[model samples]
Target: MTRTEMEARVRELLVDLAPEFEADAIDPDEDLRQQLDIDSMDLHQLATSLFEVYGVDIPESERADLVTLRAIVDWLDAHVSR
Candidate 1:
């Protein structure tokens, strides 16, 4: 998938996981967890959801790379098949 598509998909998943927040308001460069006030479990759920959707496994060692929206999109763009 394209980077824009990946970003949209990620935002959709995030909004589903955290309904209090709006997808469009998410700052791509900000720390998602901090911005959303979500915990690690929420992050795990996001990774799981992404894997289920795109079949891309984000290993625990690389979870740190998923700190921001842009990072998640970039990570998915680099790992996921188009």
Candidate 2:
């Protein structure tokens, strides 16, 4: 997928987990957990959902690497096979 597509997917995932967060207000550079009020459990669910939806593996160790929406989209772009 293109970078734009990846970004949209990540935002969609964030919106799924945090419905209270307005999609338009999401800051790509902001820490998703802090900005969206997503707890560890929510993040865990996100990881699982990503794997299920995208077939991308996000090991527990690398969870820290996906801090923001932009980071997650970029990471997935690099990790996922074309």
Candidate 3:
């Protein structure tokens, strides 16, 4: 998928998982964990949810790379299966 599509999907997943989060307020460069009030479990859920929707393996080693919205988009652009 294109970067635009991936970015939108990432935001959609975040909102789907955490309805209280301000999806539009998420900073592209800031760490989302700190931007929002979610805990570790919430992050795990986010990763798994993204994997389910994108068919991507967000391995524990690579989870750190998904800290920000821009990072998620860039990471997926490189890792997503065609």
Candidate 4:
């Protein structure tokens, strides 16, 4: 998928994972956990969701790289096949 579509999908996943937060208001460069008040469980859920959606497996060792929306989109862009 394109980067724009990846970002939109990420936002949709974020909204599903944390409905209390406004996904559209998220700062792409900010730390997702802090910005959205999400915990490790939520992060794991996000990783799982991404894997299910894009067939990209984000190992536990690399979860830290998923700190921001931009980062997640970039990671998916790099790993996911068109």
Candidates' TM-scores? 0.94, 0.91, 0.85, 0.93
In TM-score terms, candidate 2 sits at 0.91
lDDT of 4 by residue, 1-82 (tens): 5788789889999999889878688899999888898998998898889889988898778778879999888888888999
Per-residue alpha-carbon lDDT of candidate 3 for residues 1-82, written as tens digits (9 for 90 to 100): 6788788888888777678876786778888888776678988888788778878777889787778889888888988887
- Model 3 clash pairs? none
Best by lDDT: 1
Error of 4 at 73 (Å): 0.6
lDDT of each: 0.89, 0.86, 0.80, 0.87
Question: Candidate 4 has which clashing residue pairs, if any?
Answer: none
**RMSD of model 4 against the true structure:** 0.9
Q: Tally clashing residue pairs in candidate 4.
A: 0
RMSD of each: 0.8, 1.0, 1.5, 0.9
**Runs in model 3 with CA error above 4 Å?**
none
What CA RMSD would candidate 3 show? 1.5
Compute the lDDT for candidate 4: 0.87
Candidate 2: where is the Cα deviation over 4 Å?
A: none
Ranking by lDDT: 1, 4, 2, 3
Model 4 misplaced regions, further than 4 Å: none
Instruction: Mark the 10 consecutive residues where model 4 has the least summed lDDT.
Output: 57-66
